[model samples]
Target: MISPHKTLLSRFYLIGVVATIVGILVVAILNLATPLEFIIAQLQTLRQGGEFLWIHVVAYRFAILCLLATFACVPFLVILRRVLTPISQCLSLKNRQQSLPPPLELKAKQRLINLPFIMAPLNILFWIFIPLCIFGGTFAIDKIDLAAAITFFIRSTMVGFVSSAIIFFGVESHARKVLIPLFFPKGELSLVERTAKLSILKRLRAFYRIGSLIPLAIIVLTLFVLYLQVNAETVSGKTYGQGVLNFSIVVFILSFLGSGILNRQISRSIADPINGMLDTMEEIKRGNYQTRVNVVSNDEVGVLGDATNRMIQSLAEKELLRDAFGRYVTPEIRDEIISGRIPLDGEFKDVTVLFADLKDFTPMTEANDPKQMVQILNDYFKEMSAAIKSKSGLILQFLGDEIYAVFGAPVSCKDHPSNAFFAALDMEKRLKDLNKRFVQQGRLPLSHGIGIHTGQVLAANIGSPDRLSYLLLGDAVNLASRLQTLTREMDARIIVSAETKQYLPESQTRNVLVRHPQPVQIKGQQTKVNIYLIK
Candidate 1:
């Protein structure tokens, strides 16, 4: 009993003492006020017929037995302490303390949850002994006849049953509210296997038996006994039977009161845990996956709470993975791949590709500190990537001083050329604003060149089987790099091939772009290329 959870066991042991006191009180009242007195009066009236009653003599015998029964509870309490000691010891050992074996922890939980059921029959058998006590003590000591002895046994059994019922549920209430919590802390009731459960069906059975059936049965039996005793005398038999019937009804009402207490305890055991689970589920539905249902029972509802928590935990993990996944791909491509809107396999598609580069990147790196140069490159890429992505372009990768981007392949955009051209315009506009802030902070201003071309390329997941990347492969990719290099020689900040220029929107082209004065010759091309320069 000396364990960390001894506090819980100590409280339950105290409750057991209090419950036994109440049980004795209930049994004492029922035995004294109703059965013994009622039966003795019936016997005196039937046998002695209007004679001065000797009910006082029977009362003396019953009083002596009642005194002994009260003292007998002392040993019963000792037995109770013995039963609770193992449970206390089990609970005292922490669930994970000293690496308690799985079977041991399961056994501890099973034993605690089954405590109410375990105590029920034990209480019934103990109280069931009271009837024999009454029949033996009174028959030997008071010299009561066979009829009186039978009456004492039946009446004592009835009252004793009521006491047992009260005690069993009292133990039940305490175990659910107190002991089970310490044992099965997380409330995964279903996980506790092969155990006797006091389910709703069992509750309904007790309610009927304690509240209605048992009491009504006793009432009928008493009335039948009175009817038999009165049958021998015709004059007052009817009036006397009515009197006995009235007494039986009063006892029945008292039994219903005991049943009501049991019902209240049953209600608490079922309703409270369910309400808590419902509140936690509402929070989970509102996107608070971090919230978990409090499992506080080893019942069906407790299992449900445990299952709901599993689902919430799975959702939290998936969301975390999604945030991590975003680091590797654009949200657009990520969504497309996840939604299965785009396939990963290779296919040839005519698409526009763009590349931007720092014109004098090698000299810039030689001049600035290594850390400051990386910071500047990242700061510039951050804003430039935003501009490219604004027109539905995916920034494929960031090479040193270069932004590799594509449009109209992975996630389709019909105006791939126009989208690429406008993204270049946005980059130029944003750089001017960015340089002012950089100059204000005493960091060097930055500039870059953009090149755009539209042609066929095989777009697919590429690389070794172990590590793959979605990449565009073909002359279009190489030509775009060539066009960006031509930016320095051509003295242009942003340049575009004639293939892309053909697709640019007619509305903006006549006003915003100018044809390059010379034909652009590239290393890998068989002929010179016509191009446009961003003004």
Candidate 2:
């Protein structure tokens, strides 16, 4: 989208060029058709009783020179447009990227590039040559030919200098856009580098704009003083030069001052919101999600800030949701959902479910003090939970001293049976370690049996409205629990169902010395299921 500044500049350029052309054409037409006899006749009357006719002659010559100057300005303006259009395009692109440096830096850069060539020369022309020209012209009309001649020469020099400065400034300002890529060279800058560049650019722009006002103010003051000086002579009813001078001075001062004020205001309006946006962006870069910018003005910057704030808020909310969900699901599942890789709804997947139970828990509780049993069970559960988590398995639930864990539910793994088997092995190792501590403390040794089964199960959140438990419920879950009960009958520490034993890789399953593959009828099943005892 084209920016408002670019649009405004384009319109201004078009209007200025059109007006300049029309003015030049009108002046040229007048010069071509106007009778020199009539002008000479009028000038002769003004020159009556003067010491010389040199003033009238000089006035006619100045008029002809002005007519030629205006004509020449048209082509100069065309050449300026040719040089400036590409530069303007570059500036427009730079502005759109919003990579411009800060006001101070921009001012510095402008001083380095533009001041020496454009501003200083123009200032000299306005302050030295133009004033000398006007005063010299007046002296010439008063019959001091040598002084008038010098003044005219100074005035012409000032005009030439000023016009050249305008052309050079316009072209250079536009060309900066084209040459920026070559001098600055576009590459991916780190955040800090980009921000520093932006700061410099912004500062440079501010300084350039502020410095421009000084020359403009001087010009306005000069025009006003000149107007008053000429108007004072008119008050004595001598000539119309004073009225023309006064009107011209008023118009020039008003135009110059109004343009300067408007340009400054536009720049400030653009700069303020951009500054606010940069601050907010810096906050975000520092991981400050809580920072927000106010949309005070109904402008493009205001809208952008509002949008940025909204995006930050949205990201914060998502992070909160992800953290909360991590508590109920595995980090793997949470990440999958957050990354949009997995759907929320649970799917029927083949998973190995392991159930570990404290052997003869009721008798052990009766033998020990109730409080001591509770403490022992708490420590046992903590150890088992850690074991399961280490192998990337989720502890679905804990019922008293029994633990129900599942692998390949929320997130799947090709080696889920092996992972579940290792988890059970680790649990046994941890139990032995606990028993050693208990023995050292003169307590009873801990005994537990784990049963592993692999099958398709419906795994999801299940419970009443107030309470929810993410669980696996199917023949597979039942077979796993039943296998735990059969551990006592088989006189084994761990039992694996036929399905689990088959699914486990040969290398891992070879270590499991199966005592028997017994076909036993589960409580809810019509057919008997084969279960193996791991010796």
Candidate 3:
């Protein structure tokens, strides 16, 4: 099927050409039938030409005059075809895939819009000169009925002017509705600015104003002629009154029909796309981001569609990214970062950092196949990571056989220290379940230690511009790692620093079995730390 833009454009040009040609022919026929032949017969009689000669001579003259007038318009037709040919050929193609190139398309639109200005004056001149030469030359002949000749001249002149006006207005309207929209595409949405000076809506309204004068002119001319005949007493008052009524009725009917057709054409050109956009907006409101408006034209409405699609597409992409990025951080932190609520530079917050390591990872690696070691490591990390995430802790880093997590830094929590302790306990329970399966498969049972410390730490994106990571910096991170090493010395599954123990609420501490506190000096720390072992 032809595209809507192409179809509307084709119809516009077709109507324009048809209206112009038909208007001229109608006017010419009216002129000939009403007054031209009678005027010719009177001229022949005055010349005293024999009746036989008069009959043959007058018919020949009328035919020659009409033929000359018709032939004189050929050059104007050629000019019009040259201007409109590209548009016609482009739209006439059966395959829509063969779209006109951008430059050619713009050229075609430029020519189409300029068509009326170029043809209207030329055609107007043709109409004026043709009527003047034929009637004026004949009127110059001697002894003709002066009144009859004058009437023929006046009537023919009126026909010419009215016909010219019809063609001009008709062609202008077509350019606005068809040519502009069809040639300008969605990609050229901004180019509508370039046409501000030649706005189609403004031009169409101007044509409507000028076209209104045609019927008014006809009314005045009819009344003037009737007044002249009445003064001369050549026609009865009743006949003149009847003629006025008939003329008024014909004008009203034609004007009403013409207005209806113009109204429909103008309204359709603008309404269709707006309605499509409204429906698309409704779809978007219902969260249907995938929906897109079918761009039917290159005007303002098409531009609006393009912008709307881009906005929805952007939202869809962000949703996809949010889901994918959420895997790296807790969903709360992910939402905070994406929403620009998180401070990326760095911030100090009290957080419990947990570090867990396989108790005998080196021995396990030496005994097992490399693939088996990898599988074991992945399974351990997956189980531990889920436990940590479930407790609202963000996994900061995974250093081979070890996991580091932070709570209440990127996103604050009033009970983060306790949450970290509970997550470590959950990890111990998950590890027990994993080891039972490993022993059933004749594999060694796995054991790990977790050390958690609560303190003020600097959490920030740190490293080179090209490569950076969210790190928990300051003595708190060191304290956590040091405590993990002490887990083996203390012969405990989990160890908590004095700082972390103090932060845990009594309600949570009551559920956890804790060993008596011990004062131990950790490596690289001058001050001794008090720590408790979890049973």
Candidate 4:
């Protein structure tokens, strides 16, 4: 990376060279293109000994004036360079140099903002001085009368305003584009109340008043001056008619060219940001939620960009959540939860809660390689989950070697109890297929027991405000888990509580039994539970 010192030095040279050339070109082109004897007329007014040798005299004086302007620049540049020195020296400090001290950065930013404001007034002073040296000097020498001197002075001041605007915007561009970024890097520089902010509103008004209005004004002033001096003549007795016409045309042409240049510059500043935001928005529409707008100013457009970035951040987080939950929850239920169609505060609805645990899986984990065990478990869950989802059940979680699922709350179905009973059967079938593959691969076979119960559950999104889950809560959920534990004692692959068995469609099994939930040895707390064992 280029150090800050070199960037600052380059910016100063660029602004100085460009602004000086444009200023000199506007003033000299208009002043020197007079048709005939205008230079001779000026020399006669100054009482110079240059009636026949006016061309040489004028060239010599103009060259001396250029030298004088250069001399004036030396001291002004020295002070400005001193202001830039501290930031450059600190940033260039080797190694440990990524950050700037806040105090130093703010001070450096203030100096940069002051550059265009400071340079512009001095530039306008020089333009004003040129007219004074010519017409005012003649008036002092009693060669030209006060009325003529005043007339030309007014015209020069208007042209000076236009020329100064060019210089002001030129330096301002360098300050905003390069120097401020090198020094400050962040924060709104336009809000640094030390100077007047050159905002878009001010820029439009400047171009309107100075670029367009002032040129038309200059043309009118030129015609009035010629009308007043219509019979005026030079040493060779040439009329002032063509001379004034030539000066007006030169001013108009320079003004038109300057307007076009400034217009294009300002338009780019606005259009580029707006275009970039449109492209970013298009990317977001196509699901690229991570894209953001680059903010470069504190103006209205910059505020819009900051707002867009904030909105994109929110959407990116939501997109991440949707992708993560999509694996566990069905799309229809997830959409209802996100869209606020399903109430978060609990609601009572009849649903079937199911829990399935892999039997003898703990000993299998100890015997198998850890990674191989995980692969077997993932395959088991994948197959079983496919069965549950096909019947419109939402798998709530896969807890180690177990699956916990629910049907008919967030999304209601008429046959949810039947769906849960059939899903349990499907899980058994898919698990057998998985066991066959596992045994073929020299992996241990797997088996699981399922318990399902149907009852009115207070089902809703439950958890803290920022995070929540659509869960069934009541005795039914505990009863279902208790029955899965009962599976080992009963030697059954699937068990159902009586409440759920009643809701099963086309129920045929006459396998109801009464059994205590606890061991018969633990006699005191035993309660008789009615259950059905599914084959």
The number of the candidate with the highest TM-score is: 4
Q: Candidate 1 or 2, higher lDDT?
A: 1
Root-mean-square deviation per candidate: 5.9, 17.5, 8.0, 6.4
lDDT of 3 by residue, 1-535 (tens): 7665555555544544555455455444434333223433555474787777767976886686557645655665666667677777666552455867776666565565556556666676776666566666766775334554555456455544544545555665565455555554333444433332223465367447534655566556646644654532554566556656765776565545545555555455567667878998898889787877655444566567678767778988987898887876778888887888878789998889999999988987998899998988888898998899888999888898899899887888988988999999899999999999889988888988899998998888999999988888889999999999888987888999888888777786766747455688988888999887875
Per-residue lDDT of 1-535 in model 2, one digit per residue for the tens?
8775456345425433443333333323322222222333454576784755667656776686576545544554454455344435545656676554465344433332332244324433433544355547655676334433343344334333333333333433332333422323321112112122123344346445433543354344434433444434324443344433444464355435534543554455556557877898888789777877644332355446567767888977887888877654568866865686654345687999999999888998998899999999988987888788777788877887888889886788888898888898899899899999999999898888889999999876678779877777688899899888778776788988788877777786675646374588777778988876765
Which candidate comes out best when scored by lDDT?
A: 1
Tell me the spans in candidate 3 whose CA falls farther than 4 Å from its real position: 1-253, 362-379, 433-446, 461-469, 503-508, 524-526
Q: Summarize candidate 1's per-residue lDDT along 61-156 as a digit string, tens digits.
A: 568656755664666666666767656556556543655557776776777767666665665565557657766777888766556567556755
Give me the runs in candidate 2 sitting further than 4 Å from their true place. Answer: 1-321, 324-329, 344-346, 362-378, 438-444, 463-468
lDDT of 2 at 85: 49
Clashes of each: 2, 23, 0, 0
The candidate, 2 or 3, that scores higher on TM-score is 3
Between 1 and 4, whose lDDT is larger?
1
What TM-score quantifies how close candidate 3 is to the native fold? 0.63
Query: What is the TM-score of each predicted model, taking all chains together?
Result: 0.71, 0.47, 0.63, 0.72
Candidate 3 least-lDDT 10 residues: 31-40
Candidate 1 error regions (>4 Å): 1-11, 14-73, 82-111, 139-237, 240-248, 325-354, 357-374, 388-393, 399-402, 406-423, 429-445, 453-491, 496-511, 517-530
Q: CA shift at 535, candidate 3, in angstroms?
A: 4.8
Estimate candidate 2's alpha-carbon lDDT, on a 0 to 1 scale: 0.60
What lDDT does the true structure give each of the candidates?
A: 0.73, 0.60, 0.69, 0.71
Between candidates 3 and 4, name the one with more favorable TM-score.
4
Global fold similarity of model 4 (TM-score) = 0.72
Local error of candidate 2 at residue 501 (angstroms): 0.8
Using lDDT, rank the candidates from best to worst.
1, 4, 3, 2
